[model samples]
Target: MKRYTDADTYDNKIPSVVTIGTFDGVHIGHKKIIEQLVEAAMQNNLESVILTFFPHPRMVLQKDTNIKLINTIDERIQILEKTGLDNLVIHPFTKAFSRLSAGEYVEKMLVEKLNVRHVIIGYDHRFGRNRNSNIIDLASYGIQNDFTVEEISKQDIDNVAVSSTKIREALLDGDITKANVYLGYNFMLTGKIVRGKELGRTLEYPTANLHIKENYKLIPKKGVYIVKSEIENKTCYGMMNIGNNPTVNGTHQTIETHFFDASFNLYDRKIQIEMLKRIRDEKKFDSVEDLKMAMQQDENFSREYINSIL
Candidate 1:
């Protein structure tokens, strides 16, 4: 699939059937819309285009809103690439871009740059300087520009909204199973492995400390999770802890994964871990031995869960 980083980067050579959104999480509901989008483009003999935004509009327009996204832009791209889209455009969302009027956004970005021949959008989607334009306004603009607008049904839009909300809540509550159900896939955390205090080594369960660069990526509740990752061409299942090593008097939150039955020098390697299930909430144990015992228990629980799936 072709990718354009911004409106300026798009060549406007292909008249396309387009959909636009932040498309966070790329959940099952969002997938349904993309399925329709691809079908529309195929039926109409045009390329299928998805125009998404980064820096999330909220992060730009409302700087104080501490909003964490379900997927980082790179993660979003990784998911969208599998959806049969013909083109993906990730536009940078900035204060200057947000100030475009309804007509200007439609004419400049959609019509001129994307060469959009048809738009498949959610009923609740809003645009323009103040988000003052709705699907109805977009339809009117489509008429003026000689394109068409297909508004996704309220039911579908509501499902998308509810799925997004439920997924976020599930993740925050450490309900990876529930989040994956709504997402139609395991939610992943991708990061580079960095050297951490060798406390895990001393405990006999060495871990690869993960450092995620995107602060806006939503982290699931601090706890233990059963996870899997592809490392050096092998699928490794592991138990991961996302928390501060409180027993060691460590105050910074860290993500560390200890792969079962697998050993590798993973420091400095970038890895993507897909959460399978939530094991348990993080606990503050009485001593290092108690914490070690708890880690053992977590490993047993994770292995059982992994075996059940296998």
Candidate 2:
């Protein structure tokens, strides 16, 4: 798929079929929209495109807000690419851009620049200054401007509508099992391995620590989990810890993983960990021996869980 940092990059090309949204989590609902978009693009012989923003508008609009994002831009891009879209346009959502009137934005960015032949938007989607523009307004503009406007109905599963906010709530509460049901896949975190205190090695359970990106990603509640770790593009069974080591009097929350029966110097290596199940809450053991024993139990459970699942 072609990725464009700005719509102007496609200035000389014909307008494509475009869908605009934050697509933050790329949840099941977003997948439905993308599927419809691909179908629309195929019918019209137009390139499928996704238009999303950076810094998440809420982060910009509310400086003191406590909004934790579910996916980083890179992660969002990876998920979008999997949707089979032909192009992705990442727009910088600055205050100035937000000030554009609905019509002005469509005229300049969408109509003129992107050559957007068919614009697909959610039925309740809004944009422009104060978000005064709704699908009805956008459809009117499209009618006047000679472009087709497709308003997709909101998707609901089992009578529950899927949304980014609900998914975030589920994740924040450590309900990954529920979140994954909505997300249609396990929630994953990808990062480069970093050096830790080698506590795992000392305990005979060598681990790789991840240095996660600070923005647009949220760790699950402090706990141990069964996970599948990916290194060198290969997946392996593993156990993960997400917490501040209370037993060691350490106060930094981190993601540490131990690949079952696999050992190598993984420092600075990129890895993706797909969280599978929450094992238990982070606890403070009485001593190093106690911690090691607990970790052994965790590892055993993790291996069993992976075996049962696959």
Candidate 3:
């Protein structure tokens, strides 16, 4: 897929069948729309284009500091690359851009800049300053701009809405199975391995402490989960803990994964963890020995779960 960061410099001879959204998780609902966009483009002999925004419009326009996303911009791009799109444009969302009128957005960005031939959008999609334009307005604009507007059915829109909300709720609730079902893939957390207090080593379960740089990327509920990762070219199953270690009187929350039957020096390596299932809630143990025993049980349960799935 061809990726463009600067839409102003993007010049394409072939008109594009376009869809626009943040596509945060690229969940099943987003995939359906992307599939339609690709199929329509192929049928019409036009290029398929996805116009997405970065820094999410909410972050810019509303100053939404509490907004958490299922995927980072790079992660979104990586997932969308697998959708067989012809072009992907990551437009920078700024306050000035948000102030554009509906007409200006359609004429300048869609018609002049992208050379869009058709737009696949949800029925409830809105744009322009303060989201003043609805799908009807967009279709009207398309009539004047010489492009086509295809409205996704209300059923599909509801599915997309429900799935997006459920996916986030599931992850936050530590329901990895339901989240994965909604997403059509495992929920992933990627981070760099950093040094911890080396407490896991003392328990004979050395773990890699993960440090995610993206503050907007949502972390799952604080608990133990069954996860998988590829290390040394092999898929390894592990149990991960996301919590402050109450047994050790730790002050900060941490994500630590202990891979079963695998050990390596990953202090500086970046790794991606795909969560499979939630094991149990984190709790304060009476003593270090009790915590060690619980860790062993978690490892055993994780191994059984992984084996059963395989």
Candidate 4:
């Protein structure tokens, strides 16, 4: 798929069948919209286009508020690319772009610039200044501009509509099993291995510490989890600890993973860790020996659980 940053880079003459939204998490609902876009584009022999923005609009509008993103811009692009779309447009949103009226935006971006034959959007989707655009407004504009506006209704999983907020709540509560059910896959973190204090080695269970670079990515709550770690593209069973090591009086929070039946110099290497299940809450042990015993049990449980499942 071609990634176009703006109209100047989008030199294709192919009529675009476009879908526009934040597409946060790329959850089931977003999947439905993309699937419909793909089928519609294929049926009409049009190019599939996705229009998203860098630095989520809300983050720009609400500066002081804490805005945690479900996926980074790079992550969102990766997900959209896998959906078989022909063009992915990441418009650089600015103050002037945000100030455009709804009608002006539709006329310029949808009708003239993109040459959109058919535009697909979610039922609750909105655009332009003060968030005034709605499905009816889009349809009216579409009628005037000689184009089509399609609204995709929400998709539900187990009577609950799949949403980014719900997934965030699940992760905040350390309910990754339920979160994965909503996300349609395991939650993963990819980062480079960094040097950490030599604490785990003292306990006989050496760990590779990860330094995540994606600022918007959310980390799960404090706990240990059964995980699958890919080091140099080789997957291995592992146990991950996500918390401050209270047992050793550590002050900094850490994400440490120990791979089962694998050993390598992981320093400076990139790794991707897929969280499978939360094993137990992080706690302080009575002594170093007590912490060592607990670590043994955690390792054994993680190995057996991952072996049975995989």
C-alpha lDDT of all candidate models, in order = 0.92, 0.82, 0.91, 0.82
Query: lDDT per residue, candidate 4, 1-310, as tens digits?
Result: 8898876578558888888877767777677668889999999999889888877776677662467766767767777778888888888877788999999899888887788888887677788788888888998988998889876755532223446778889888998898888777788777889999968899888999988887677888899998886666688888899999998888988899988888889999987788999989999999999989998999888878877887
Candidate 1 runs further than 4 Å off: none
The TM-score measured for candidate 1 stands at: 0.97
What's model 3's lDDT at 260?
A: 86
Model 2 spans > 4 angstroms off: 154-161
- Model 4 stretches astray by more than 4 angstroms: 154-161
Q: How would you encode candidate 2's per-residue C-alpha lDDT over 167-198 as one tens digit per residue?
A: 88887788888888888888988898998888
Task: State TM-scores per candidate.
Answer: 0.97, 0.93, 0.97, 0.92
Minimal lDDT window, size 10, model 3: 4-13
**Candidate 2, clashing residue pairs?**
15-115
lDDT of 1 by residue, 1-310 (tens): 8888887888777699999988899999999999999999999989899998888887887884578889988889999999999999989999999999999999999999888999999888899989999999999999999899998999999999999999999999999999999999999999999999979999999999999999999999999999999988999999999999888898899999999999899989988999999888888899999999999988988888889989
Considering TM-score, which of the candidate structures 1 and 4 is the better prediction for this target? Answer: 1
Give each prediction's root-mean-square deviation over alpha carbons: 1.1, 2.0, 1.2, 2.2
Colliding pairs, model 3: none
Model 4 lowest lDDT segment of ten: 153-162
User: Of models 2 and 3, which has the larger lDDT?
Assistant: 3
